[model samples]
Target chain A: MKVKIKSNAFLIAVSAVILGLLAGGLLMMSIGSNPFEGFYYLFRGGLMNMERIGNTISTAITLMLVGLSVAFAFKTGLFNIGAAGQMLVGGLCATLVAHYVFIPRPFYLVVIIFCAFLGGALWGVIPGILKAKFNVHEVVATIMMNWIAYWSIYYFVPAYLKGPSLETESKSIAIGQTLRSPWLTGIFGGGYINLGIFVAIAAVFVIKYVLDKTTLGFELKAVGSNRFCAEYAGIKVNRNVVISMMIAGGLAGLAGMAYYTGYSRNIQIGVMPSMGFDGIAVALLGASNPIGVLFSALFFGMLQSGKGFMNAMTEVPPEIADTIIATIIYFTATSVLFSRFWDSVGRRKRDKAQQKSDQDESKEEVSHE
Target chain B: MNNTTTKQSLFTSPLGIAIYIVVGLVLLAVMATNHLIGMILPYAIAYTIPLLMTALGGLYSERSGVTNLGLEGLMLVGYFASALTINLTEQTLQASALPLGLLAGVLAGALFSMLHAFASINLKADQVISGTAINMLASALTVYLARTIAGSGNVRIMLGIVRRDIPGLSKIPGIGTLFFTQSYWSTWVALIVWGASWFLLYKTSFGLRLRACGEHPSAVASAGVNVYGMRYFGVGMSGALAGLGGSIILITYSGEFNGTVAGLGFLSIAALIFGQWKPLGILGATFFFGTATTIANVSQVIPQLGVIPPVIFKVFPYVVTLLALIVFSKRSAAPKAVGEAF
Candidate 1:
C-alpha cells in the first residue's frame, strides 16, 4: 500500500512536468513554430558537440553550487535570497586576489577559490548577524544585501582593477592564473571544463554527509523542524541560524569562482545573475536533498544547453525553456500536498499490520497467562 | 534608581539618535564630493521618487505579513500594460493620454496582483514560492507579449508623454535642474503617492487593520476583520505602486519598455528595508539610494569623476546598498510578521 502510494505521488509529479512541457510546446506551436523540431535541436545542440557539452558542464557546475547554497539555507529553515549579491562579491574578491596575488598557476587557483569562499561568506554574515542579534527577518535582510553587493562590486571592480579611464571591464587574469584544465590542455586542445566541477560535486557530497550523519546537522534539523522544541532542548537557535547562513553564503561564493575562474574570465557586477534566484527553483524542485539537487541541476543545465539548438533548428525562441523550467518549479513547490497523499496510504498499511500482529500476540499472551 | 535606569535605557535603545549620525555622514559625503554634490544629487532625487513609491507599495504588503517577491515580475507587467495602453491611445488623444495611461496602469497592476493574492491567500500556498512563480510567469509573459506587439524584445512609444516644467520652482538654483528641467508626470505622481500613502498608513483605520493583520492575523480574524481581504488589499496596493514605477521608467526615462528593468525591483526592496518601514525613513533611504544610482549613470558627465573608471561609479549604488543593509540590519525594524503568510 505504501509503495503504491509512493508510486502514485511520483506519477503525479512526473505528469505535472509533462503537462508543463506540453503547454510550452503548444504555446510555441500556436505562434507558428514547430515544437518537435525545436526540442530535437535543443538536445542535439547542447550535447551534440563536444565544445557545447563542455559549456553545459560548466554552467551545470555553477548552477549546482548556487542550488546547494539555497538548499543549505532551506535545511536550516532560512531563505537566503542574497546569493546573487554574495556571488558578485565573491567573484569580485576572487578576481582581485587573482590579479594582485603573484604566484604559480596551480597555487593561484587555490588561493583565489579560497578568496571567493571568504568573500561570499562575509556577505552572508551580514544577514546572519541581523537575524541572530535582532529580530529582523532573514528574507528582507538578504534581499536588501543583494543590491548593496551589486553596487559595491560595481564601484570596486572598475576603480581598482583599472586606474580610472575605461568603462569596460578589467583586464583578463594573468597567464599563470587563467583557469585551464590540465588534462584538456594535454589532450583535447584547451577545454574549459576544469576540476572545479569535481570540487562542486565533492562539496555536495560533504554537505549531504554532514546533514545526514553529524550532530550539528541534527541540531540544525531540529531547529528547522521546530524552534520551540529545539529551544526547550537547550540548543542555541541563534548560533545555528548564523552558521547556516554562513555555510549557505560560502557555497554561493564558490559557485561564483567556479563560473569565473573555470569558464568566464571577466566579472560583470552590474546585473543580478538571476542564477541565484534560479537556485531557489532548483532547490525546491530537488526537494532540498543533495542528490535531488544534482539531478535537478542537470535537468536545468540541459534545458539551458538545448536552448541554442531550439533557436537554430526551429522558430521557437530559447526563452520557451525558461517558461517550462518555471512551471516545473511551481509544481515542485506544492510537493508537500503530494507527500501528504502518500502518508494516508502508509497509515492504512500500518493499521493492517498492527491488527494482525496484535491478534496473534494477544492469543499467545492469554495462553501464557 | 528609576532615573538612572531610564537614562541608561535611552542610551542603549536601538532607535537612538545614532541612526541620525549615520544618515548625516552619508549626506555630508554626497555634499563634500564635487561631482556627487553638484551633478548627481538632482538626478538621484528625481529617479528615487518612483522607487520610493514602489517601496511604499511593498510596505503595504509586507506590513500585512505577505512578502511580495513577485514585485519585479508584477512591475514588468504593469509597465507593458501601461505603455501599450498609453501608446495606443496617444494617436487619438495626444496630451490627455498620460493620466489615462497611469489610471490604466494602476488597474492593470491591481489585476496582476490579484493572481498572487489568489494563490497565496485563497489557495493557502506558501507566500514566497507563490511570489517567485509569479515573477517567472511575468517575465515570460511580458517578453512574449512585448515581442508580439513591437516585433523585437523592445517596445518603444513613438509618441510618449512629454515632461512638465514646474513654473516657479523651475528657476531655482543648482537643485532645480534635476527636478524642474523636463520633469516627467511620474514625478508628480510619486510625490502625491508618498503623501497619500503616509496618510493611508498612519492616519486611517484601514492602515491600523492592515498592521494588525500582519502582526497577528488569527487575532485580527477573531476580532471580525477579514484577514484575507486585508492581505489581498496589501498585495494589490504593492502591485499598483510597482506598476506605476515601471510605467514611469518607460514614459519618462526610456520612453519604451525593454529587458533592462533588472535591479530596480531589488533596489526598491532594499530602499524599503533601509527606510526602516517608516514613511520618513523611506524618504531618506530612497533619496540616498537614488542619488547613488544617478551618480553611477551620469558620472561620465562630470569631467572630474570621469577620470576614474566608469564601471566603478556605475556599480556604486549596489555597494552603498550592501553597506547600508549590513549596518541597518543591526538596527532597523521590519514588519513584525513579514514572511509569515497569515
Candidate 2:
C-alpha cells in the first residue's frame, strides 16, 4: 500500500504526459499533418544541434525556477497564482538594480538577484497576509496582485526605462550586468544559456533538502495536509502559510531575474509573462515534486523551443503548438482525478485477492479440525 | 422629531449613506469640471453591461459550489462564436443575423463550459486547475480556429452596427442623454437579464437548491436532491450568461473578437467578491468598475487630464479593484463550500 501510494503521483504524471502527447498528435492529424513527422520535427527543432539543446536549457531555466516556486507553494497547500505578479515585480527590481547599481561584477550580480527575490517576496507576502489574517481567498488576492503588478510595470517601464524606439519595453541591460557569465556561454558553444541554469539547479537541491529534511517543511506540509489537525498539533498555521508564500514568492522572483536579466534581458509593458501561468502547468505535470518539476520543466522547455521549428517544417500553424501546450496542461491539471481512479482500481484488486486467501485458509482450518 | 431620528439612523448606517453622498459629490464635481464626463456615462453603462453579466454568471457557478475562474475564457469563446457567426452570415442575412449570432455564442459558451463542468464535477478535479485549463484551452482553441477559418487571428463582425437611440426614451431630460442615447439594444437585453437573474436567484426553488448545493451539498444530497445535477445547472447557467456577456461585448463594444477579452473576466470575479455574491451588490460593483474604466478611456482624450500620466489613468481601475477587494473581501460572504469537490 505504501509503495503504491508513493508511485501514484509518478504514474499519473507519466500517463498525463502520454495522454497530452497523444492529444497533440490527434490535433496534428486533424490539421492534415503526419503526427510522427510533426513530432520528429518538433524534437529536431529542440535538440537538432548543440545550439538548439543549449537554447532549450536556457528557456527551461526560468520555467525551472517558476515551477519550483509553484511546487513549493503547493506542498504547503497554497495556490500561488500570483507568480506572474511576483515575477514582474522581481524582474522590475532586478532591472532597476542592473541598470543603476555600479559595483564589482560578482557583488552587483548578488545585489540584483537578492533585490529580485525580495521584490517577489513582497508580492507574495501581501496575498499571504490577506489569506492568513482575513481568510480572504488566496486565488482572488493573487489574481488581483497580478494585475496590480502588470499595471505597475506598464507605468514604470515607459516612464523610467524606455528603450531606443519601443514604447512598450524597457531598455536592455548591459551584458556585464546580466547573469550571463562568459565561461558558461562558452561551455554551451556560444549559446544564450547562462548562470541562471546553475541557480535553478541549486534551488532544486535546496528546496528538496528543506522539504525532505527540515522541521519547517514538515510543519508546512502538515498544515497543508490538514490545517485544523496541524493547529491541534501545535503548529502555527498562519506563520507557516506566510513563510511558505514568501519562499514561493522568492523563487518566482529569481525566475524573473533569470528571465529579464538572463533570458530576454528586458521587461515589456502591457504583457504578463506567460511563464508564470505555465509554471502552474509545470508543477501539476511534475506532481509538485522538486525532481519531478526539474524533468517536466525540461520537457516543457523542449516543446516550447521546438515549436517554432515544427511550425516552419510543417504546414501546421504556430497556434497549433499553443493548442498542444494547452492540451498538455489540461491533461496535467486533471492528473489528480486520474490518480484517484487508478488507486480505486488497485484497491479493488487488493480486496479481491485478500478475500480469496481468507477462504482458502478457512477451508484448511475446517479440514484440520 | 421622528423624521430627525430617521435621518440620524441613516447616518449611523454609514456605508449606504456614504455611497450615496460620494456618488452625489462625484456627479456634482463631474458636472462642474467637464460635460465630457456626462458623455462618458453612456459608454460606461455599455462597458458595465458585459462585466455585470459576467459577474452574475460567476455568482451562479460559485453559489452552486464550483469555483469558475474561467469566466474570461468562457466569455472569449462566446465572443469568438458570435463573431464568427456574424462574419459567416453577414452577406446572406445582414443585420438580421445578429440574434442568431448571439444564440450561437451562448451555445458555444455553454458547450465549452461543459469541459470545465466535467473535470470539476465528475472527475472531482481541482476546481482552480480545471478552470485554468478551460481558460488556456479556450484562448488557444479560439485563436487556432480563428486563424484557420478567417485566415487571421482575429474575427471581425461587420454586419450589426449598433449606434442608435431608443425612440421616446431618448427624449427624456437628463436621464435620456445618460441612459438611452447612442446605446446598443444589447444594453436593454443586459438590464432585462439582470432583472431576470435577480428573480431567478432569489425567488425560485431551483435557486434555493443551487445555493444549498454550494453551501452544504451533503445536506442537500440527504434531502434527496441531486447535488451534482444542481451544480451542473449552476455551471450551465453561468456559461450561458457568460456567453451572452461575451456576445454583448462583441456586438456593442469591440466589434472584433481577438484571442483575448482584455481582463474583464478577472475584473468580474473581483466584482463578484466585492458584491458579496448578491445580485444587487454585483450591479453596484459593476457600475463602479465600469465608470472607473470609462474614466480611464476618456482621460486619454480630455486635455486637462492629459497632464497626468496616461498609464496612471489606465492603472486606476485595477488599483481601485484591488482596494475594493482588500476592503470588502473579509466582510463579504462567499459560498462556504466554494472550491470543494462534492
Candidate 3:
C-alpha cells in the first residue's frame, strides 16, 4: 500500500514505441511481407546517401517546430489544434515577404522569420481569446479556424500570389530570397538543406532554457498541472493561456516558414499542411518535452524521407509508415494501461528491498545479544 | 461593453436565430432571379443529409458525456465499408446492392466504435486523445486496405440512387415543389431518422437515463442505471448514424469512396454546436450550412454569383460558426460532463 515508486514517463514512452513497432510489424506480416526485410529497407532508405540524409534533416526541422508548438500549448493545458491554421498564415506571410520585401540579405531573413511568427501568432490568438473571454472550447474553435485559413489561402494565393502561368501556387522565390545558403547546400550535396536547420536548433535551445530556467515556463506548467491552483497562487491564468497559445502559434508559424521558404519553394493553395496533425503525434510520443520532441521529430522525419525508397524496394506502400505512426499514437493515448502495469512492477521491487532490510536488522540484533 | 450590445441583437435568441436563418435563406432564393430553388434543392438536400445524420450522431455521444472527435473516422470507416460492399456486390446484386452496402456500413461503424468505447469507458482514457487516435487509425487503415483490395486507394461504385419526385407529394403546390420534387429517397429516410431520434432522445425513459449519465453519472448510478452501458449505447448510436451518413454520401452524389470526407466530420461538430445540441436545431443548422455550401459549389458556374467571389460563399459557414460560438458562449448547451474522463 505504501509503494512510493514514481511512475516513470520515460519508460512508459519507450514501451509505447516498442508496442507500436510490434503492431506495425504484425501488420506487415498480415500483408504477407517479411517485417524484418521491410524495416531493413526502411532504415537504409533514410540514411542511404548524403542527399537523403539532408532531406531527412530538412523534414525534421519543420516537424520539430510544429511539435514544439503543440508541446508549448500543451504545457499551458490548451490544445492548439489550429497549428495547421497558424502554419498556413505563417507560410502566406513568408511567401508574401519573399515576393515583395527586398532588403539587405541578413536583414531579409530576419524580417521573413519575424513576419511568419507574427502571422502565426495572429492566427493562434483568436481561439485563445475566445477561450479566455467567452469560454469557447478551443478544439471546435481551432477546427473552424483551420477551415477559414484553408479557404482564405485557397482564394488569397491565386488572386494575389499566383505565379505567371500557374494558378494553384505562389510565385517561386529566388534562391537569394529563400533560407538556402551555398555552404549548407554544398555540405548536403545540394539537397533541400537551408538556414532553417540553424533556426530549429536555436529554437530547441531557447525552448529548453525557457522550460527549465524561466518563471513564465513555471507559470505555464503550473496552470497545466492545475488551473484553479495556479490562480490561487496569484498567477494570471487567462493571460498565461493567451500567451502560451500565441507562442505556440508563433512556433508553428516558424514551422510553416521552414517548410514553404526553406524546404519547398512556394506555398500551394488548398492544402492544409499535414505536419500540423503529425506534430500532435510527435508531441505525444515525446511526452510534450522539447528534447523528446526533437528526437521524435527526427525519427518521424526518417520514416517520411525513407518512405519512397522503401515503397520502391519492398512495395509495402508509403502508408505503412503512417500506420506505424498512427498505431504509436493509439498506444500513447492508452497510456493509462501502461501506467498501471509499470507501477505494479515498481511495487514488487520496493517490497523486496524492504524485506531484505528487515532480515539484515534481525541478524544485527542477534549478534548484539 | 460590446458584449452587451451584441446581446441585444435579435439573433441571440434561438427562435430569433431560426427565423433569421430561414428569412436569410429565403432572401437568397428570391435574389437569384429567374432561378428555381427546386433546381438547386436536390443538391442542397444531398449536402445537408450527411451533416444532419453525422451531427445527430454527435448529439448522441455528447449527450451521454463522451466528446466524440472520432465521428470523422467512424464516418470514413462506414464510407469504406459501404464502398467495399457495393464494389463487390454491384455486378451480382445490381439494384439490391445498395441496401446491403448501407447495412454493412452501419454494422462496421458500430463494431469499430467499440474501440473508442473500450478506451474511454473501461480503460478510462482521455476521450479526446482516444478520439484523435481513432481518427488517425481510421485514415491510415482505410487507405491501406483500399490500396490492397482495389489495387488503388479509391473504391468506386457504379450504382447510385435515382432522383425522382414523389407521386402524391409532388402534386401539392408550393411546398411539394421545394420539398418533394426531384428528391433522392434518402432525404426522406434522413428526415424520418431525425424525427425518430428526437422522440427517442426526448420522450423515452432510455433517453432520459442516457442524458442523465452525461449530466451526473454518479446520480444516475445511484438510481440503479448502469452508466457505462448507457454511454456505450450513446457512442454506438453515434457510430451507426455516422456510418449511415457516410454511406449516404457514397450511394448518392459521390458514387466513390476516395477517402477524406473533406473535414465534414468536424463541420458536423460545428453544426451540432450551432444547433445547440437539439435535433430541431441540428436540422436547421445543417440545412443552413448545406445551403451555404451548395451555393458555393454551384456559384462558380452561375453568372450572377460570379460577381461576388466564390471564396466568400466558401468561407461563409466557417466564419458564421465562429460568430455563433461567441454568441452562444454564455449559455452553452454542451452536455454538463462532456469530455470529462469519468
Best by TM-score: 3
Better of 1 and 3 by lDDT: 3
Q: List the residue pairs that clash in candidate 3.
A: none
The clash number for model 1 is: 12
Q: Report candidate 3's fraction of native contacts.
A: 0.71
lDDT of 1 by residue, A316-360 (tens): 766777778776666554544555656777788899899989999
lDDT of 1 by residue, B1-342 (tens): 133443344357555445446557656755677555645644676678767877888889888878787777777877888777877888898877877777776777778888777766765567787777777777876676666565667777766656677888978986676567766666776888899988998899989889888788898899899998999899999999888888777776677877546767767887887777778878877887777677667668766557766666665565556555555555446666776756
True contacts kept of each: 0.37, 0.57, 0.71
Measured on C-alpha atoms, candidate 1 has an lDDT of 0.74
The C-alpha lDDT values of all candidates are: 0.74, 0.84, 0.86
* Candidate closer to the true structure by TM-score (higher is better), 1 or 3: 3
Task: Chain B TM-score per candidate, please.
Answer: 0.86, 0.91, 0.93
Model 1: which docking level applies?
A: acceptable
C-alpha RMSD of each candidate structure in angstroms = 6.2, 4.1, 3.7
Clashes of 2: 0
Q: How badly does each model clash, as a count of residue pairs?
A: 12, 0, 0
TM-scores of the models, in the order given: 0.83, 0.92, 0.94
Estimate the lDDT of model 2: 0.84
Worst 10 residues of 3 chain A by lDDT: A1-10
TM match of model 3 to true structure: 0.94
